[model samples]
Target: MSTEGSVSNDREGHVKTEGERSFWGRLANWGLYQTLMTVITLSPRRQFFILAAFPILWLLTQHLGPMLQMLRVSLLDAYPVAPDVAQEFSLESYFKFFGDPIFWMPLFRTLIFAAVFTLCTLLITYPVAYFLARHVSRKNQMLLLLILLIPFWVGEIVRTYAIMILLGNTGALNLALKWLGLIDRPIPFMYTSFSMGLGMVYLTALYMLLPLYSALEKLPKSYNEAAADLGAGAWSRFRKITLPLTIEGISSGSTLVFLISTGFYATPVLLGGPSTTVFAETIAGFFHVAGDEWPTGAAFAVIMFIVALLITGVFQRLMKSLRKGESS
Candidate 1:
């Protein structure tokens, strides 16, 4: 009787243990299912904010910190005359930049040069980009692209020097021209606006080309085919369809080229005369060559930054408007 009782006790213990385990398993499954549902039900906007938080924090720390520091420096009365001494906070530098024609004139010249260069870059690069995107065979396209990129292998400074050599009074082009009796005297090509523009164009041509090519490449060939089928001539198809599709690229390339060209110092200094001084040169002169006026340099830098921001904002709005019009 005792043995039978012992066997029954063992069986009861085993059943109780299984019941406890099943209860815990059901609890665990319920918690896991609830978690999954919560995750699935999260709003996309909330998720995006969560995902973007770290990157936004990082960017703020990187960019805002330096900008604040620069602004503080600009606000202080600093001069190069006494390198070791610090002056009280003053608006002298900002006033100097605004009140002085030397600073303002160069800034104006810089704007004009950048605008002219941007226009020339667009005019020259658009046709080349269109041809490459639409006309060339795949095999030849690759080869031509390689050729276009070959000039970039050389450094910008080296290329500028090369331009100097080719355009200098006694340079190869001048020698050839003399041999051909094109001119009796060698031309003074270096240290001129023409040379400055040429160098700027050469350095920035690729910038314009890549964006334009990408824009043109994204255009549907079907549009052109349909236009042709509808008795539209080649020029008409290009004017109506191809040009409209590539405006974004043109705007993007122009903005980039203009911004870079505006801030250009080395090319202008090397190739341009005194009359062709750019804003960047003025900033450099204030900081290093003329006198170490940190506040003045900072003021100029701030103004340039604001101008660039304005240009970029305008371009973005224009692009958006164009896209909306196209969609409509």
Candidate 2:
């Protein structure tokens, strides 16, 4: 009878262990099924919308709110006295921007400066990029790149001041020239558009160089050799093969240089005089020198941002179309 009882007890223990394992297995399968169902039920569009909401919310909080507030104030005839104050919206700031040539002229000038600087940067960086990508050894390429980045290790303000010292009438260049008897008097190079452009180019040249280098580096030598084998000349090979391949890099770099150049404040302020005033300078004047009009400053900032965006979009689209043409 004792032996029979022992066997029954062992069977009961085995049954309990099996039951516990079965319960956990069912729970895990249910969880997996729920997850699969959720994924299968959501449409692509719905999933996209859900995923996009976070970024949209972030943008609204960070940018759109300030932009709307600025637009509201810019349209007001008079500044509000308090946070709760209400007034009718007017187009005074927009009218001021358009009707006054001072505001519009500076905007145009800024655009011109950015364009010219970008073009100059491209011209200067392309040859260096080509040499680094095609001719240089890997170790030397890295060393040369490091040399280019060395200037940026110093603060921008320090670099600008260094440029100032070098370019000033009584500065190092003038002293050296005078010592060499090259000129009778010190040349006035400071506080001019030339100086400002030089400074802008110096600051932003790396942006152009890096992208162009990256694009050129990825190009295989086989393409150039093939073009040569087909009886293509050097200029023809470069124009048809090399330039076409590096279009994406050129576009990206130019856009970055242009955008940064438009908003440049410190370099322009230090190197430029009255005639070389940019839109950023005007925005600064409106906020700090003038009666601290946050709304007007905000409006200017938004307009500048939109203009930059449009320019970038157009450039990217043009590049895309060109790429498509080349592929076809």
Candidate 3:
């Protein structure tokens, strides 16, 4: 009786062990979750690449797929008819873009606004960043950055309305002017190029500041000291040493600020005059206002997309040239 009981116990244990193995085998055949966890079963290198590829494939489909479809639409005459009808895919929309000043004028204005906004933000941010990088201690730097980040914690629309309160005719700024007897009437500060530019600067300053601060922080103080020891003037040292190293920051900040500025819709529309219509506003109008002119809108968007690429290419070329000059 004792021998029989021991054999029975060994059989039960073997059956339980097989059940666990079978459960895992079934799980490995299940969908995404199991597959993800099964990465541990893969070799480390293969696991890492698979992990990286997942998000990259997802991003490409999410972002690039729509862009390609838009490009295709831009090449088609989908307006005035169904998008799938007897539409001869041609460059008429593009030619319309080139032929009409109305289409291209927004492009020009967008470029101007982008350039000015980027430049203004750079100028404003550089001094603040330079002071922080060169003067402040590490502990103090964190505190100051925290202070600077407070305003940006709010939403973009909230920040814009805050500017409106400051710049409105009967708003705080005007009230202050009245209190101080600075003017007899409120200045027109809310809806003009000046206001628009100021709004852009306020809205986009951080994009430029962070890069400048990072670049300047990484700069070695020894370069400046060495230049000074060689009797280099302040301006000379800055031009030769300081500026060269910070070029990456400047380019990165400028590119981001300019690209983002070109897409300004609400800020420019609310704060600027009719003359300051930008690419985003135009693109929006084509879709929202004129339902039939979607192809034209698509074409305008494609053109603007190319323009953005051109701006990026210009910056890249400049950076490459700078790198080459440094290398040589």
TM-score of 1: 0.77
Clashes of each: 0, 0, 0
Q: Using TM-score, give the best candidate's number.
A: 3
- Model 1: per-residue lDDT, tens digit, 204-317? 999999999999989989999999999999898887788778888988899899888987778888899988888998888767755457777877888887887797779778
Candidate 3 TM-score, true structure as reference: 0.82
Ranking by TM-score: 3, 2, 1
Q: Write the per-residue lDDT of candidate 3 for residues 268-324, one digit (tens) a residue.
A: 878877777787888888888766677789889889978887987898689868966
Give the 10-residue window scoring lowest on summed lDDT in candidate 2. Answer: 19-28
Q: lDDT of each prediction vs. the true structure?
A: 0.84, 0.84, 0.84
Q: For candidate 3, give the lDDT.
A: 0.84
lDDT, candidate 1, at 32: 82
Off by over 4 Å in 1: 1-58, 79-87, 289-292, 319-328
The parts of candidate 2 lying over 4 Å away from their true place are 1-59, 80-84, 289-292, 322-328
The alpha-carbon lDDT assigned to residue 264 of candidate 2 equals: 83
